[model samples]
Target: MSYFKEDFKYDLTSSIVVFLVALPLCLGIALASEAPLISGLISGIIGGIIIGFFSKSSLSVSGPAAGLVVIVLDNVEALGGYEPFLVAVSLAGLLQLILGFAKAGIIGLYFPTSVIRGMLAAIGLILILKQIPHLVGFDSDAFGEMEFFQADGNNTFSAIIASLENFNNGSFVIGIICLGLLVLWESKYIKGVKALKQIPGSVLAVAIGLILNQIFISSGSALAIGKEHLVSIPILSGEGGLTAALKFPDFSAFSNYQTYVTTITLAIVASLETLLSIEAVDKLDPHKRHTPKNAELKAQGIGNFVSGLIGGLPITAVIVRSSANLDSGAKTKMSAIMHGIWLLLAVAFFPTFMNQIPLASLAAILIVVGWKLTKPSIYKKLLAVGQQQFIPFVVTILAILFTDLLIGIIIGLVVGIFYILRANYKVPYNYSTGEFKTDDGREAIKIELSEHVSFLNKARLQTTLDGLPNGCHVMIDGSRSKEIEFDAMEVIEEFRINAPERDIVVSVKDLPGGKGRMA
Candidate 1:
């Protein structure tokens, strides 16, 4: 109780900021997913109210994620219709719950820090590149679409070029002005002011954008923004309108095998995305608090089950909204919950007003957020960490830029694992050739095996034994090892058996199957 009250003011302010950020995203993800616009709103609402309430996460904002847009679209088409697809989503939620209870969430802990950082950096770059089209009033692609190859005919760079060719001067002006205000709002002077500090810059930028467009309209200026340049939130007029807008799940589809396949697909993808986002969100947390991964999965399961049961798209913890929440000064889960409440209220009562705000303004805000995420300092810091870390970090960023999030992450993970193997391959044991006392006081070459030797060390171990000088006395020691892999032990045994052929004296101590001197 005190937790909510202590940060109520900050949380309220941040909730409004997140609401402004999330509104277009909800619509855009819906647009990208080919799901009904109201369904997006429903997911956002459930993500906020239900997931936010149940989630242990302090800053993560769950909603219909952009990552699942393609998956949702294809499954809907494959399953014959949106109604049947809803059954898959609900079943996916059940699978997520099973996963949580099974403690599968620990998989998130294995993601290399460099890969996670790269994911965030890639998303930052995507946010900047993708939002440019919106900023210029080229609204062909949906707002939340983040893939390299968009559902629209154009790719990321091509979209920017296309937007430049057919740019809207009004949108450009609003975006530029709003961007300037956001930058200025962060200046030392504005931040130092007590009265201004409480108010969020994004709110002011959005407000000014509205006023600027209205002023242009009043004067009948050529710079007046058009409906195409503004937000397009659907208004729910009454109960009939609500019913007409939402489509329910076809429960009968549960018996279909394809439905189960789609359910498994959604559960896996959504779980991975959620786990990744949770990692990134925790990294961004100023307080450095940890979110229990299992708890988050359960919360997402509930959110998805409720969303699909009613008529919403699939849900996941989204990094963009979470980053926006952090940038907006959110202090607790209240901001997330309140954002959902605000989404519900705004759509129900003020859809017309929301529709008036220019998309350009929101684009400007996201651009700033994007820049913060992929700042130059981050690149420099990772570079200083060494190539092992930096390579995967950069690879993840580029992969995500050229591909979608999951593909990029998988690619990055592979690269990261390769580095891990390379590192392990380099030093399997300590090799020292010196005049030392063997068990009876004779000079011998000493080979101290590493604590845990795997099969990867077999080849190197064999090569070392093969290179030993003929008739040289050698000591292969494993007394300190906790576990030696069978493959590595085979190399030791083979060397011991063959030592007599080379007239070499070999001593094996504390090793499996070979613990005595070899003549």
Candidate 2:
């Protein structure tokens, strides 16, 4: 009971913040994918409520992801319509279910810590850069796009430039005021007061934006924010309201080859994105709780299945929503589930009120979230960790800033692997010279093999053997090793065979294949 009371208080407020952040994104991503506007809402509802209910992650918020926009657009067109695409989405969900049962979620465990941190920082940078235009009331591009290159022919930097040229005064003022309010709310002084801390800055920002715009209108001022800069959800009417907005999948598409191909693509991409999002959210969780990856995949599979049946876009664990949830102090999955309930109720009963919300207010909230993610202190900390970590971390951030999320992660992994291999190359074995000599008084060289030597150690082991002094007694010890690769053993064998050519004496000890001296 105590846990529920404490968690509910935080969850209630966090849900409202997540709902506001998710509303525009759902619509914008659907618009970008060329799907029915209501489809996004349907997917968001399923992701938040159903996925949240089933997911092991308390902090991760699932939704229709911006990452799938391009894939969805192309497949929807190639498959000849939205209904057929829904068919593919359903099949994809089935595939995801199979993958989860097969424990494919273990794939996420392979991502290095540096790469994961880099991904977080890169996303933060993207949010700050991409939200700038919306902050200033320039809404030419979609709301949730994180890719460097946009569908509107503007890159991230170019969009910022364009926003400056097309700023709206009313949006500028509201955004500035909201941003200031949020900053003030987060200050130590405000947090010191119990009363002030309970008041969420995001809600205050929304209220202020609405009231300021209304004041502008009542005074007949030109600075009034127009409907174009506000949230625009499709309101349900009294008659046939639910049925009119909902779409159903065309099951006949199951026989189509293109549908199968699209299913495979969606399954792979959505599962990967879902895994990454959950991983990222787990990193951001204040409690540092670990989420079961396989459970998350199963939850996402169910979400996509329900979404597709109702003619919704495919669903995945979205990092933007998940991060927003975490930053807002969500303590349990209840926050996500409540956000979905709010989305449903808003569409059914209160869309007009919701539509009054200015995009700038939401943009302000996201800007703060982004800042928290890519703070300079994080960079300094990573740098302090050393180059092996810092290099890949920096590389991942730059790569993501220039490309899409998956591509950037792949690039970071490549850099990380190179460092791993280089480290292995430099330290294959422990080489030392003993002052005590053999019976004949020749200087003795000793090479102690590592516990698990692989093929990566072959070259260095060979080099060490070749550098042995002539007429020296050398000892290669593997008695302490757990396993030695064929490559390293071959190098030792070859060196022993040719040792007499240089008047060198070779003695091999307790190696796996053989037990005694090859002198």
Candidate 3:
């Protein structure tokens, strides 16, 4: 009971920090998914409250993952509407449940360490690149859609250039101000500000955004955050009840093969992402917490099923929120539940207040999160680990930058495996005496060299054989040997040739053509 009480306090503080971080991410990811903003919130709430309660993880935070954005958008567009997409999401959740029950959660363990690290670094890089334009108040379309090459017309780099070319001075001013305040709050100077220390930097940034917006409104400036930039929840007014905003899935689309294919894709991708996130969060936990992977899968599946039924996008254990929770000192799962409850309450009672929060402010928070994940210090640390580890790490990073996550991982795994084989190939074999003894001394020697033994193992095999006593019988053991290389087999043959002068008999057993000993 005492332990529970202690953890409760920590959970409250940590959940608040996570909530602050998650609010904008929920909206951003929903926008990226081509789903309604409220749908994202609904998922967030269910993920936090419902999944949080059932999950065995103490540090993991669940919500809409950025990795699923492309898939979600494509599915929604293909399915024609959000209702049809919900049906797919529900089916995907059911598939994940089956996977968990089958103990397929262990599949995440097979991914190479180098590849996993590369995937994370790549995600961090993407987050930074994608969020930069938003931080600068240049949201041309939805969030996370800014690619290297333009999907429609402008690429990520081009979008940045265009934003700079037609920069909104008012929005830019507010963003810069909020960014500056956040920087100041994070600085050492704020250490002495005891009361202010409790306030999250995101909260302070939001305050600045609101103040700037009010000032702009008073001055008749055209640079305020427009309706497109703010979070839009479909709040039920007096005439329309809450049921008006709520939507159910249209299962009629389930008969379509495309719908089934989309659902399977979603299920596989979502499960992989969730399992990976669960592993990463466990690794990041300060207490060295071990999350039950199967339990987590079940919880996520349940959450997604419920969320889809209530018109929400699919949910998963999101790294961004989980990292924030850990960094903010969350001690147990209760914090996640609290955050979910807060999300529901805030939307239900304070939609008007949430609408006042500026997009730039959330963008600033994400910018900080991105920088934390891809800090120069992390790179320096990776380099300090030495080339053996660094080679694969660096390769993974580059592969991820050039290709997608799954492809990048495969490349890194191949490189790591090659390195391992190369390292192992350096060992030399010693069969000069033709007397190999097992550690238990129960197994006899059966020395048979390949047709082509290289010079690489010459010295090693030579040293081993030369150190043997005179009583041990030397055997050429070339029964199955054919076309032996001059460099390696010649060395052994030369030793056999000269052994007669050293009171040693070299006997060849079963030569290639059934010939006896070679004089």
Candidate 4:
């Protein structure tokens, strides 16, 4: 009871914040995908309500991901229509389910900590860059794109240049005011005040944006944010609007090869994004809780399945929403679920009101969110950790800034692996040498194996063994080692066999092989 009360108390404030944050993003991603406006809402609803209800995660929020917008747009065109794409989404959900049952979710665990941190930082930086245009009502670039290269062929830097000419002064004014409000709302003193803690600053930003928009209209002010700069969710009119909006998948295309191809593509992309976001969210969670990866996959499958049924685009655990939820003081999955409920109510009875919101306001909110994700303090802390980690972390940020998310992560992982192998190869074992003569007064060398010496140390060990002098006692000690690679052990044995040729005495103590283990 106490836990429930504590969690619920946080949920109310956070759920509204997440809802406000997610609303425009959902619509923007759909606009980028060229999907129906309602499709994004459907996916957001399923991701928040259904996935959150079924998932064991305490903080992750699922939704229509911007990462999938490109693939969705392409597949929707290739498959000839939106209805067939829904079928692909359903099949993708089944694929996710099978993958979860196959235990493929453990793949996320293999990513290095440095690479994950780099991913978070890179995403933060991307959010700041990509949302800047929207902050000023420049809509030339694809909405919700986080990659360096855009769907319209402009890279991140070029897009910013374009935004300069495309800026709307009205949006610029609203965004600046909202940004200031959000920043003040997040200040230490304001957060420390108990009364302000009950109401989220993002919710207030939305209200302010709406009121200011109305004031601009009623006063006949030329500075008013127009329809293009505001959210434009189609207002539903009674039961007919709901019926027309719900798109069902057509199974007639089941035998089409493109259908299967689209399914496989969506499944792989969505699952990977879901896993990556889940890992990222776990890192951001204040309580240090871990979301079960396999369970998360299963929940995503269910969310996508339901989303597809309702004519929505594919669903994934979206990092933007998850991060927003975490930053807003979410303590349980209920925050996510309630956010979905808020989406449902807004879409059902209040879309016209929602449409009054300025995109600049939401952009300001995300700008603040992005700033929090990659604060200079985080950068300084990573740099303090040392070159081995900081190199990979920074490499990831640069790669992601210059490329896409998955590609950037892969690049960072490769660099991280290279550093790990280099570090391991440099010092796989510890050694101390003494001129302890044998009974014949010949000097000997003693080498001690370090714990968990892997295959990477193979060549180094062989080189040292080859340098042994004739008529000398050589001792290789593995007594202190808990794990030595079989290959290393074999190298020891080979040197032992070859020692006779050099008139050298070779002795390996507690080496894992032969009758012991490694042989």
Best by TM-score: 2
Q: Per-residue alpha-carbon lDDT of model 4 for 1-519, expressed as tens digits?
A: 986767887888889989988888888888889988889889999999999998999998999988788799899999899999999999899889989888899999988888898988888888889888988889776557776877777888888788888798888888889999999988898989999866888888888888887888899988788898888777778899888877889887797899999999999989988888899899888788988899888898888888887899899988788888888888889999999999999998888888888988888888888888899998899889998899999999999889878888889999999988889887877766673556766676888788878789988888888877778787777888899878887888888887888888766778766323211
Tell me the tens digit of each residue's lDDT in model 1 across 226-287.
99889998988899988899899998897788999999999999999999999999999999
| True-vs-predicted CA distance for residue 100, candidate 1, Å | 0.7
TM-score of 2: 0.96
| Reference-based TM-score of each model | 0.95, 0.96, 0.78, 0.95
RMSD of 3: 8.3
Ranked candidates, highest TM-score first = 2, 1, 4, 3
List model 2 lDDT by residue over 192-226, tens digit each: 99999999888889999999998998999998999
Best by lDDT: 1
Candidate 2 wrong stretches, greater than 4 Å? 239-241
Please give the lDDT score for candidate 3. 0.73
Clashing pairs in 4: 512-518, 513-518, 513-519, 514-519
The lDDT, on a scale of 0 to 1, for candidate 2 is 0.90
The number of clashing residue pairs in model 3 is 0
What would the per-residue lDDT of candidate 3 be over residues 393-452, giving only the tens digit for each residue? 778777766655555667887888766555434443325332654343332333455544
Point out the higher-scoring one by lDDT: 2 or 3: 2
After the best TM-score superposition of candidate 3, give how far the Cα of residue 281 lies from its true spot, in angstroms: 1.9
Task: Give the runs in model 4 whose Cα sits over 4 Å from its true position.
Answer: 1-4, 435-437, 469-471, 514-519
User: Candidate 1: TM-score?
Assistant: 0.95
